[model samples]
Target chain A: MRMDRLRELREAKGLSREGLARVAGVSAKTIEAHEYGRTSDVSVSIAYRIAAALELPLDDLFSASLKAVTLKEAV
Target chain B: MRMDRLRELREAKGLSREGLARVAGVSAKTIEAHEYGRTSDVSVSIAYRIAAALELPLDDLFSASLKAVTLKEAV
Candidate 1:
Protein backbone atom coordinates (compact mmCIF):
# COMPACT_ATOMS: atom_id res chain seq x y z
CA MET A 1 0.00 0.00 0.00
CA ARG A 2 1.03 3.68 -0.41
CA MET A 3 3.33 2.89 -3.33
CA ASP A 4 4.09 -0.65 -2.32
CA ARG A 5 3.69 -1.50 -6.03
CA LEU A 6 1.79 -4.67 -5.20
CA ARG A 7 -0.60 -4.21 -8.09
CA GLU A 8 2.23 -3.54 -10.48
CA LEU A 9 4.16 -6.52 -9.25
CA ARG A 10 1.14 -8.83 -9.59
CA GLU A 11 0.41 -7.49 -13.05
CA ALA A 12 4.01 -7.95 -14.08
CA LYS A 13 3.70 -11.58 -13.05
CA GLY A 14 0.46 -11.80 -15.07
CA LEU A 15 -1.56 -12.75 -11.99
CA SER A 16 -4.92 -11.41 -11.01
CA ARG A 17 -5.26 -10.35 -7.38
CA GLU A 18 -7.43 -13.39 -6.73
CA GLY A 19 -4.93 -15.68 -8.39
CA LEU A 20 -2.06 -14.31 -6.38
CA ALA A 21 -4.09 -14.56 -3.21
CA ARG A 22 -4.76 -18.22 -3.91
CA VAL A 23 -1.08 -18.94 -4.21
CA ALA A 24 -0.25 -16.77 -1.23
CA GLY A 25 -2.86 -18.46 1.02
CA VAL A 26 -4.53 -15.21 1.84
CA SER A 27 -7.91 -13.73 1.03
CA ALA A 28 -8.35 -11.69 -2.12
CA LYS A 29 -9.61 -8.99 0.23
CA THR A 30 -6.17 -8.86 1.76
CA ILE A 31 -4.54 -8.52 -1.62
CA GLU A 32 -7.02 -5.85 -2.57
CA ALA A 33 -6.38 -4.15 0.74
CA HIS A 34 -2.67 -3.99 0.09
CA GLU A 35 -3.15 -2.91 -3.50
CA TYR A 36 -5.52 -0.11 -2.54
CA GLY A 37 -3.43 1.11 0.39
CA ARG A 38 -6.23 0.27 2.80
CA THR A 39 -3.68 -1.84 4.63
CA SER A 40 -0.39 -0.02 4.49
CA ASP A 41 1.68 -2.21 6.77
CA VAL A 42 2.09 -5.83 5.80
CA SER A 43 3.23 -8.50 8.18
CA VAL A 44 6.50 -10.17 7.30
CA SER A 45 4.80 -13.56 6.98
CA ILE A 46 2.26 -12.21 4.51
CA ALA A 47 4.96 -10.41 2.62
CA TYR A 48 7.07 -13.53 2.57
CA ARG A 49 4.17 -15.60 1.26
CA ILE A 50 3.40 -13.10 -1.47
CA ALA A 51 7.05 -12.88 -2.42
CA ALA A 52 7.22 -16.64 -2.59
CA ALA A 53 4.20 -16.63 -4.88
CA LEU A 54 6.03 -14.23 -7.18
CA GLU A 55 9.41 -15.94 -6.78
CA LEU A 56 10.87 -12.78 -5.36
CA PRO A 57 12.55 -11.78 -2.14
CA LEU A 58 10.33 -10.39 0.57
CA ASP A 59 11.82 -6.90 0.27
CA ASP A 60 10.91 -6.72 -3.39
CA LEU A 61 7.24 -7.04 -2.45
CA PHE A 62 7.16 -4.07 -0.08
CA SER A 63 7.64 -0.33 -0.32
CA ALA A 64 10.63 1.21 1.44
CA SER A 65 8.45 3.13 3.86
CA LEU A 66 6.47 0.05 4.90
CA LYS A 67 9.70 -1.88 5.18
CA ALA A 68 11.17 0.72 7.48
CA VAL A 69 8.15 0.68 9.75
CA THR A 70 7.74 -3.08 9.79
CA LEU A 71 11.42 -3.72 10.41
CA LYS A 72 11.60 -1.20 13.21
CA GLU A 73 8.69 -2.74 15.05
CA ALA A 74 8.80 -6.07 16.83
CA VAL A 75 7.37 -9.00 14.94
CA MET B 1 13.57 -27.41 12.48
CA ARG B 2 15.72 -29.98 10.61
CA MET B 3 18.71 -27.89 9.66
CA ASP B 4 16.79 -24.65 9.64
CA ARG B 5 19.69 -23.08 11.54
CA LEU B 6 17.28 -21.39 13.90
CA ARG B 7 19.37 -22.12 16.98
CA GLU B 8 22.55 -21.00 15.33
CA LEU B 9 20.80 -17.89 14.15
CA ARG B 10 19.42 -17.04 17.60
CA GLU B 11 22.83 -17.58 19.14
CA ALA B 12 24.40 -15.46 16.47
CA LYS B 13 21.88 -12.75 17.20
CA GLY B 14 22.75 -12.94 20.90
CA LEU B 15 19.29 -14.17 21.77
CA SER B 16 18.23 -16.99 23.99
CA ARG B 17 15.39 -19.16 22.69
CA GLU B 18 12.89 -17.48 24.95
CA GLY B 19 14.19 -14.05 24.03
CA LEU B 20 13.89 -14.75 20.37
CA ALA B 21 10.47 -16.24 20.89
CA ARG B 22 9.39 -13.15 22.77
CA VAL B 23 10.49 -10.89 19.99
CA ALA B 24 8.89 -13.05 17.36
CA GLY B 25 5.57 -13.18 19.19
CA VAL B 26 5.74 -16.93 19.38
CA SER B 27 5.97 -19.30 22.31
CA ALA B 28 9.29 -20.77 23.41
CA LYS B 29 7.69 -24.15 22.82
CA THR B 30 7.66 -23.33 19.14
CA ILE B 31 11.28 -22.27 19.26
CA GLU B 32 12.25 -25.41 21.13
CA ALA B 33 10.27 -27.49 18.69
CA HIS B 34 12.14 -25.86 15.84
CA GLU B 35 15.58 -26.07 17.46
CA TYR B 36 15.25 -29.76 18.22
CA GLY B 37 14.13 -30.48 14.66
CA ARG B 38 10.83 -31.81 15.89
CA THR B 39 9.42 -29.46 13.30
CA SER B 40 10.95 -29.58 9.86
CA ASP B 41 9.02 -27.06 7.85
CA VAL B 42 8.46 -23.50 8.91
CA SER B 43 5.46 -21.52 7.79
CA VAL B 44 6.47 -18.36 6.02
CA SER B 45 4.96 -16.19 8.74
CA ILE B 46 6.90 -17.90 11.48
CA ALA B 47 10.06 -17.78 9.44
CA TYR B 48 9.50 -14.12 8.70
CA ARG B 49 8.90 -13.37 12.38
CA ILE B 50 12.04 -15.17 13.48
CA ALA B 51 14.08 -13.53 10.77
CA ALA B 52 12.69 -10.14 11.73
CA ALA B 53 13.52 -10.76 15.37
CA LEU B 54 17.13 -11.20 14.34
CA GLU B 55 17.05 -8.35 11.85
CA LEU B 56 17.83 -10.72 9.01
CA PRO B 57 16.24 -11.58 5.72
CA LEU B 58 13.83 -14.52 5.78
CA ASP B 59 16.28 -16.75 3.91
CA ASP B 60 19.00 -16.23 6.53
CA LEU B 61 16.94 -18.02 9.15
CA PHE B 62 16.27 -21.06 6.99
CA SER B 63 18.44 -23.90 5.76
CA ALA B 64 18.59 -24.43 2.03
CA SER B 65 16.75 -27.72 2.16
CA LEU B 66 14.02 -26.32 4.32
CA LYS B 67 13.78 -23.29 2.09
CA ALA B 68 13.36 -25.52 -0.91
CA VAL B 69 10.56 -27.50 0.70
CA THR B 70 8.76 -24.51 2.14
CA LEU B 71 9.00 -22.53 -1.05
CA LYS B 72 7.81 -25.47 -3.09
CA GLU B 73 4.77 -26.08 -0.92
CA ALA B 74 1.64 -23.99 -0.96
CA VAL B 75 1.84 -21.15 1.53
Candidate 2:
Protein backbone atom coordinates (compact mmCIF):
# COMPACT_ATOMS: atom_id res chain seq x y z
CA MET A 1 0.00 0.00 0.00
CA ARG A 2 2.92 2.28 -0.33
CA MET A 3 1.95 5.49 -2.14
CA ASP A 4 5.40 6.77 -3.05
CA ARG A 5 4.96 5.46 -6.55
CA LEU A 6 1.50 6.96 -6.81
CA ARG A 7 2.75 10.38 -5.85
CA GLU A 8 5.71 10.07 -8.17
CA LEU A 9 3.42 9.11 -11.01
CA ARG A 10 1.12 12.02 -10.30
CA GLU A 11 3.99 14.43 -10.27
CA ALA A 12 5.32 12.98 -13.48
CA LYS A 13 1.92 13.56 -15.04
CA GLY A 14 2.17 17.22 -13.97
CA LEU A 15 -0.90 17.09 -11.77
CA SER A 16 -1.32 18.91 -8.50
CA ARG A 17 -3.01 17.40 -5.49
CA GLU A 18 -6.10 19.49 -6.04
CA GLY A 19 -6.18 18.66 -9.71
CA LEU A 20 -5.95 14.97 -9.07
CA ALA A 21 -8.58 15.16 -6.34
CA ARG A 22 -11.02 16.84 -8.69
CA VAL A 23 -10.46 14.24 -11.32
CA ALA A 24 -10.92 11.50 -8.75
CA GLY A 25 -14.04 13.07 -7.23
CA VAL A 26 -12.47 13.22 -3.80
CA SER A 27 -11.50 16.07 -1.53
CA ALA A 28 -8.06 17.63 -1.69
CA LYS A 29 -7.46 16.66 1.90
CA THR A 30 -8.26 13.07 1.06
CA ILE A 31 -5.73 13.07 -1.71
CA GLU A 32 -3.18 14.79 0.44
CA ALA A 33 -3.66 12.36 3.26
CA HIS A 34 -3.36 9.44 0.88
CA GLU A 35 -0.17 10.80 -0.59
CA TYR A 36 1.29 11.21 2.89
CA GLY A 37 0.19 7.74 3.90
CA ARG A 38 -2.18 9.08 6.53
CA THR A 39 -5.25 7.21 5.40
CA SER A 40 -3.96 3.73 5.02
CA ASP A 41 -7.43 2.43 5.70
CA VAL A 42 -8.90 3.42 2.39
CA SER A 43 -11.62 1.78 0.33
CA VAL A 44 -11.04 0.00 -2.92
CA SER A 45 -12.93 2.72 -4.75
CA ILE A 46 -10.38 5.33 -3.78
CA ALA A 47 -7.63 3.04 -4.95
CA TYR A 48 -9.29 2.91 -8.36
CA ARG A 49 -9.44 6.68 -8.58
CA ILE A 50 -5.75 6.91 -7.73
CA ALA A 51 -4.82 4.34 -10.36
CA ALA A 52 -6.96 6.07 -12.94
CA ALA A 53 -5.58 9.47 -12.10
CA LEU A 54 -2.00 8.27 -12.09
CA GLU A 55 -2.51 6.28 -15.29
CA LEU A 56 -1.22 3.18 -13.55
CA PRO A 57 -2.54 -0.30 -13.14
CA LEU A 58 -4.49 -0.94 -9.96
CA ASP A 59 -1.92 -3.66 -9.32
CA ASP A 60 0.85 -1.12 -9.39
CA LEU A 61 -0.74 0.69 -6.52
CA PHE A 62 -0.69 -2.46 -4.46
CA SER A 63 2.61 -3.78 -5.62
CA ALA A 64 4.99 -4.14 -2.66
CA SER A 65 8.71 -3.89 -2.63
CA LEU A 66 10.05 -7.11 -4.07
CA LYS A 67 12.84 -6.83 -1.55
CA ALA A 68 10.50 -7.22 1.37
CA VAL A 69 9.80 -10.57 2.96
CA THR A 70 7.00 -12.51 1.36
CA LEU A 71 3.68 -12.97 3.08
CA LYS A 72 4.01 -16.73 3.06
CA GLU A 73 6.97 -16.41 5.41
CA ALA A 74 5.46 -13.56 7.41
CA VAL A 75 2.47 -15.68 8.30
CA MET B 1 -9.15 -3.16 -7.87
CA ARG B 2 -11.38 -6.15 -7.61
CA MET B 3 -12.18 -7.21 -4.01
CA ASP B 4 -13.52 -10.68 -4.77
CA ARG B 5 -10.30 -12.17 -3.53
CA LEU B 6 -10.42 -10.14 -0.33
CA ARG B 7 -13.83 -11.49 0.53
CA GLU B 8 -12.78 -15.00 -0.39
CA LEU B 9 -9.72 -14.75 1.77
CA ARG B 10 -11.69 -13.38 4.68
CA GLU B 11 -14.17 -16.24 4.37
CA ALA B 12 -11.39 -18.76 4.15
CA LYS B 13 -10.05 -17.43 7.43
CA GLY B 14 -13.56 -17.74 8.94
CA LEU B 15 -13.86 -14.10 9.79
CA SER B 16 -17.07 -12.13 9.57
CA ARG B 17 -17.03 -8.72 7.98
CA GLU B 18 -17.46 -7.14 11.39
CA GLY B 19 -14.62 -9.15 12.77
CA LEU B 20 -12.31 -8.21 9.99
CA ALA B 21 -13.27 -4.55 10.22
CA ARG B 22 -12.69 -4.56 13.94
CA VAL B 23 -9.30 -6.06 13.48
CA ALA B 24 -8.51 -3.57 10.76
CA GLY B 25 -9.82 -0.59 12.77
CA VAL B 26 -12.49 0.31 10.28
CA SER B 27 -16.27 0.15 10.31
CA ALA B 28 -18.10 -2.94 9.16
CA LYS B 29 -19.77 -0.86 6.46
CA THR B 30 -16.36 -0.05 5.08
CA ILE B 31 -15.54 -3.69 4.82
CA GLU B 32 -18.90 -4.44 3.25
CA ALA B 33 -18.50 -1.73 0.65
CA HIS B 34 -14.97 -2.83 -0.10
CA GLU B 35 -16.02 -6.44 -0.41
CA TYR B 36 -18.90 -5.51 -2.68
CA GLY B 37 -16.71 -3.28 -4.83
CA ARG B 38 -18.56 -0.12 -3.86
CA THR B 39 -15.30 1.62 -2.96
CA SER B 40 -12.73 1.46 -5.70
CA ASP B 41 -10.77 4.44 -4.42
CA VAL B 42 -9.41 3.29 -1.10
CA SER B 43 -6.31 4.60 0.62
CA VAL B 44 -3.08 2.68 0.92
CA SER B 45 -3.36 2.35 4.69
CA ILE B 46 -6.61 0.45 4.48
CA ALA B 47 -5.12 -1.74 1.81
CA TYR B 48 -2.36 -2.62 4.22
CA ARG B 49 -4.87 -3.56 6.90
CA ILE B 50 -6.81 -5.80 4.56
CA ALA B 51 -3.62 -7.54 3.54
CA ALA B 52 -2.42 -7.96 7.10
CA ALA B 53 -5.75 -9.24 8.36
CA LEU B 54 -6.03 -11.67 5.51
CA GLU B 55 -2.44 -12.84 6.05
CA LEU B 56 -1.60 -11.88 2.49
CA PRO B 57 1.02 -9.81 0.80
CA LEU B 58 -0.17 -6.30 -0.04
CA ASP B 59 0.39 -7.22 -3.66
CA ASP B 60 -1.89 -10.19 -3.38
CA LEU B 61 -4.77 -7.91 -2.65
CA PHE B 62 -3.86 -5.78 -5.65
CA SER B 63 -2.84 -8.47 -8.09
CA ALA B 64 -4.89 -8.01 -11.26
CA SER B 65 -6.16 -10.49 -13.77
CA LEU B 66 -3.24 -11.24 -16.04
CA LYS B 67 -5.70 -11.81 -18.86
CA ALA B 68 -6.66 -8.17 -18.90
CA VAL B 69 -4.81 -5.53 -20.90
CA THR B 70 -1.92 -3.76 -19.20
CA LEU B 71 -1.76 -0.10 -18.26
CA LYS B 72 1.36 0.56 -20.31
CA GLU B 73 -0.74 0.45 -23.50
CA ALA B 74 -3.88 1.87 -21.94
CA VAL B 75 -2.54 5.40 -21.97
Q: Tell how far residue B57 is off in model 1, in angstroms.
A: 1.5
Off by over 4 Å in 1: A1-4, A19-30, A36-49, B1-3, B18-30, B36-49
Worst 10 residues of 1 chain A by lDDT: A66-75
Q: Name the DockQ score for candidate 1.
A: 0.27
DockQ of 2: 0.23
Instruction: Compute each candidate's TM-score over C-alphas.
Output: 0.59, 0.50
Measured with C-alpha atoms, the lDDT of residue B75 in candidate 2 is: 28
TM-score of chain B of each: 0.78, 0.78
**Candidate 1 chain B lDDT trough over 10 residues, lowest sum:** B40-49
Tens digit of lDDT per residue, candidate 2, span A1-75?
445466777788899988887776667887777678785445555656667767665556544662133233323
- Over the stretch A1-75, how does candidate 1's per-residue lDDT look in tens digits? 232778989999999999998998878998898787786455444566687888887657656665456545544
Candidate No. with top lDDT: 1
How high is each candidate's interface RMSD, in Å? Answer: 5.9, 7.3
Would you give me the overall lDDT of model 1?
A: 0.70
Clashing pairs in 1: none
- Residue-level lDDT of model 2, residues B1-67, one tens digit each, is 4454778788889999988887776678878886788865455566666677777765566546621
